[model samples]
Target chain A: MCGIVGYLDKVGTEGGNVGSVLLGMLTALACRGPDSTGVAVFGQHRPDELIAQIKLGENGNGTEYARKIEETGKEFGGREFSQTSAYLRFVFTETNDLHAFITRVEATGDPVEVVSVGRRLEIVKQVGSPSRLEKTFGISAFQGKHGIGHTRLSTESVVDLSHSQPFWGHGYPDLAIVHNGHITNYHQLRRRYEQRGTRFYTENDSEVVAVFLVDKLQQGRGLHTAIESIVRELDGSFSCLVATDSALAFVKDAFSFKPLVFAETDDFVAVATEEVAIRNAIPGDFTVREAQAKEVRVWSR
Target chain B: MVEIDAAGRTTREVNRAIRQRIAESCKEVVLRNPGARHNLAVAILEDAHIRIAGSAGYYCGGLIDGPSIEVEGSAGWGLAESMLSGTVRVHGSAGSGAAAAVRGGTVVIHGDAAARLGVSMKGGIVIVAGNCGYMAGFMAQKGTLIVCGNAGEAFADSMYATVCYVGGEIANLGTDAVIAPIDAGEAQQLEKILSTHLPATLRSTKPAAADFKKVVAGRKLWNFDKREWRTWQEAL
Candidate 1:
């Protein structure tokens, strides 16, 4: 099991230090998933290009691998690839051709995954504790209007950077997914998606959900419609947070076995796997309510 | 003698400050009017003598270890759930599922406890001064529950190693739970344990009034039935 939290605002300045709020929420949920932590902050600047978080080897080749990927960006028309020790942040220019570009990159030996993407949405993630992610990526540095974050516990998949969430809908800008439960039908879905030329990097079932939702959204479905469609088709107990460039959506599985709580106010809206996460993210006296079964709620700024 | 008034502070700030103090320089801490502050406290104060003046929300002293915690008021659901070690005392009533999955330590509720007390307890001692709701001591593998008052019903359903002592009437004993007489030696051991964990107000009461009827698993559920068809034909 994992924990997912997201916050969006309709009025007021949503762009103020939301990174701290996201980090605080992730910290509250650290016990749910201790393997890795990640956060995506939607900044106010250029909203077209999405930030892809990639982790290279720890043998001092992080920067070199990032430069190599940056150079490879020329193949699919990407730019501005930056590198750190085991961290890579780059902007993809050709959003439409991002799927093809990601496919080519995964053919290489090095592991890579699109952690999050959105209009001005920058994803920061790393292996280890939530505190480690904050320390390594300076996740609190990014300020945005609203964002989604995740803390991963490796129940089914190996504990690697590639399997960490929230996974970006491959090639889709301003689209990201964070899941809470296992997808039992992952093998079937993976076969179908793979046959259609979709490349998968991790053995996690959550990645299939991300790809499925993105496929729906890219095929001319709205965020709410796409989420509702997946909720009906997907089998398993899951609660997910999907974010687009201008929208934030939550979808609970049919059974609603997994826990999800939300607190909405006039100023901001928050959702988390547990009520404690919502309390940690927005520190105020507010009534937290549990999400209804099979409910799909959406918020857009 | 560090007294932290958590009143008017957000749960986060209170938790952060209390955790910091516990980490830095505090062995014993006291919180005045803790009921007004709604955050998890005993969770952070492991191995410390922490006293709460008022009631606590869910999970008071949950997963506690080494620390001796006392709550002056009642406790919400799942009190001491999965508690590993140490002692937790609730002066008033406890909500449902108190001490669920406790591995060790002792929990004493001066008042009544709701349903599912000591559920799945691996080992420990839980003493309820008052009556308990239904399904008390369900799935208890290794532990002891002493109910000074009447036990509701279905006591020790699916119980294994745990022993239950009921002072008053028992509605029912589910599955393999069987009532056994408390001998002189067992009574002496119970008295000793009660003296250590119970408060003076409760300990002063006459032991005869609280004389308990011990309940334990019969161990019959572990084996499979292998009776032949001839036995059924003879009975017919």
Candidate 2:
């Protein structure tokens, strides 16, 4: 099992320190997933281009990383800039060989992990506790209108940095997800996506959720529509939080096997694995409520 | 009366100390600055009086036996879950699945409650002074849910032996749970039960049982009759 938290500023002026609140929410869920933690934050949006958050894996050196970035940037019509020691930011034209570009970055053999791909979404995550991650990434310095976070238990995949959660919809802009519970048909879905040449990074069932969603979004479906389809098509006990540059939303499994709570106020909307996280993230008497079985809720600024 | 501050301690530390104190001749325990932590004061089998001054997180006073617990503030999910014998009073609201699957207990809620208030309960007595959300007693086998206020959708779906009484509107009733007539004797019995467990102010202001609607299982569901089973299988 895992934990998820999603947030959106409804009033639009709350340029909240989204990373700080996300870390607090993730900290509340540390007991649920002690193995690793991840977060996806959406800041200022860019219309004509998509940004990718980068992390150099085991074999990435400055010289080789520059060469790989040069190669992928030329192919994708993009450019790269450093955000932090572990995080590099890349901007790409919307209609380039984006799929191939991601594959190139991922398949560098030594692994240049593309943590997220979106117009404003930049996911910073690793194999550590929530508090530890905050120290390493200066996540508290990130300011945004909305974001999503997760603490993963690592049930289906190896306990590695790249396998941590808040999976990015690699092919879709500004789409990321943090999920709790399992996907019963992940192997079948993985095979289907793999047959279609979709490159998968980890064996985590949650990664399949991001891939599945991007597939639907790429097929001209809206966020709400894709989530509704997911409730029907996917069979499992999952409660997931999804984030986009414009919105934050969540969907629960039909049986509601996993715990997910959300709070709504005039200024903001917050969702988490439990109300405790929501309580800590949002201040003052927001109306806290449970996500009903099979409920899909969306909120935006 | 014994008082303990839970401001700077983990749930483990608080619960361990509370349990230890209860074992060492502590009859009344007060926990201040609860910090709304999960699983606070869980699995106590003593007959002590435990009072939490601040809000509590999930499963507060869960599996409680023989204790009379009270919360001055709100509580999170599954409050008093699976308790055998206790009197739990929540002065503020409670989260979903409160008093779920209790074998024996008396839980009184002074304020509104969230969804799935008492799921799959085997036996218990639940009294809510305020409205409750959906599926208040879903799949309950045996218990009694008395709501002085409104009830949300699908109240008591598929309930086997559990009985429900609501003074206000019911959005929907689940399978096998139907509105049944409240005889004079049953109405008086519910009032007696409420009086015994409710606070003095609430007991005095209790709604008349005659004004409430009674709900119970559709007896046929209690037995897996061959005819009913065939009907169910065909539907499936």
Candidate 3:
């Protein structure tokens, strides 16, 4: 089991401290998955470029791997590539040609994919405790209006950084996914996506969900419709959260094997795996309700 | 001794006072007026002596460390939920899910307990003076539950390391569960436990110690069966 939290503040308001909210939410869900934590902040910065979070192989040379990623960024016309603990965050100047960059990166030796990209979107992830990840990445300093957080407990996949969730959708900037539960039909879906010129980096079942949702979004479907379509098609139990620069959506599988609770007020909307997370995130009194089975809810600020 | 008058004080205040006293002292803390009102006492004591005069609401003496809590009246649901250590004694009946998920300690119920007693228990000792409800000790990882009276059906389902002692008839044992005769050593252990926790009124006319039965889980259920028919037949 894993913990997922997504926050969206409607009404286009900015001053409402997002970093503190992420900290509180993550703290509440610390018991769900205590191994590693990650956060992606869609800040109030320039929302034109896409930020990709890539996790390379562990026990390898961090600097050498980062240099290779920086070279790849340069080739794809992206500027300002940064590295942190086996992770690479690249800022793409031309978000329109991300598909070409993804394809070109896949052609390289090591497996690489865009983890998240969108206007004002920046993904910060690491391989440690939530507090450790926050301390290393300065997640507390990430000032954003909306974002998604994940705490992973490896069930179907290994505990490597590449298998960590909040996987980015191909050709979808600022679109990242976090899931809790197994995808029983992941191999079938992976095969179909692979046939369509899509390459996978890890053997995690959760990646199929990201690919499936991204496929729908690329087919000109709205975020909510795409989520609803997948909720009916995706097999097994899952409660997932998807985020882009402007939109945040949550979807529960038809059987609703996983747990997801949401607390909504006029100021903000918070989603988490447990009610304790919502309470920790927002101090004010609010009613927390469980998301219905097969329900797809979308929020945008 | 703490004399909490529930005449006007809220249940929360009474519980808080008791909790504060338990946290501060190692001496025996007696709570007067156990039946005065409904209250939920959580983390009442880490390591002290506690006595309640009346019924306790949800989660009475929850997560007790080394202290002993004696409830004069019945207890509500989730009694002793996730208790790490200590002992809880209920003079009256216990509502559903008694001792649910208790990690360690000893819970003695003088009266009957409702369904799902000791569900998912990791480790502990539970003694019920009267009958027990259905699905007792379901999915129990480890612990011991001694029932002086009849145990409801479907007891010890998916049980791992827990040992169940039922003095009277068993309605039914769940999948992979079986009943075995209690040995002399085990009987002596139960006698020692009964002497320590059982009140004089109930212990005076104790039944024959050799009549108790033990319930255990068979290890055959751990394997994954390829054929559905084989699985169903073995389960039956």
Instruction: Indicate the residue-level lDDT of A219 in model 2.
Output: 92
Which residue pairs of candidate 1 clash? A14-A145, A118-A174
Query: How well does candidate 1 match the true structure in TM-score terms?
Result: 0.59
Off by over 4 Å in 1: A45-52, A57-60, A74-79, A92-95, A104-109, A112-118, B1-236
**Per-residue lDDT of candidate 3, residues B1-236 (tens digit):** 65555445667787777777766663666666443233456675466777766556457877767778888766766788888899888887776678988999999998877677898899999988888877788888888988888887678887888888888888889877888778899889888877787887897655656778889877546665565456447465
Instruction: Identify the CAPRI category of the predicted complex in candidate 2.
Output: acceptable
**Using Cα atoms with residue i matched to residue i, what is each candidate's TM-score against the true structure?**
0.59, 0.84, 0.58
**Interface RMSD, in order shown:** 9.0, 3.1, 12.5
Give the lowest summed-lDDT range of ten residues in model 1 chain A. A284-293
Q: lDDT per residue, candidate 2, B40-159, as tens digits? A: 888999999999876778899898889988887778889999999988898877888899998988999887777788888888898888888777898888889988888887788777
Residues A1-301, candidate 1, lDDT per residue (tens digit)? 6889998866756457778888888887898899988877777756455456665653336665666777776665567777766766667663666566666665454555445545576766667778888887777776777889999988888886767888877677667788999888899999999999887877989989888987887699878888998778888989899887687889887645566667678888898876556655565555444454477999987
lDDT of 1 at B184: 89
Residue A41's lDDT within candidate 1 is 71
Q: By TM-score, rank the candidates, best first.
A: 2, 1, 3
- Residue pairs clashing, model 3: A47-A119, A47-A120, A117-A173, A117-A174, A118-A174, B34-B53, B34-B54, B35-B54
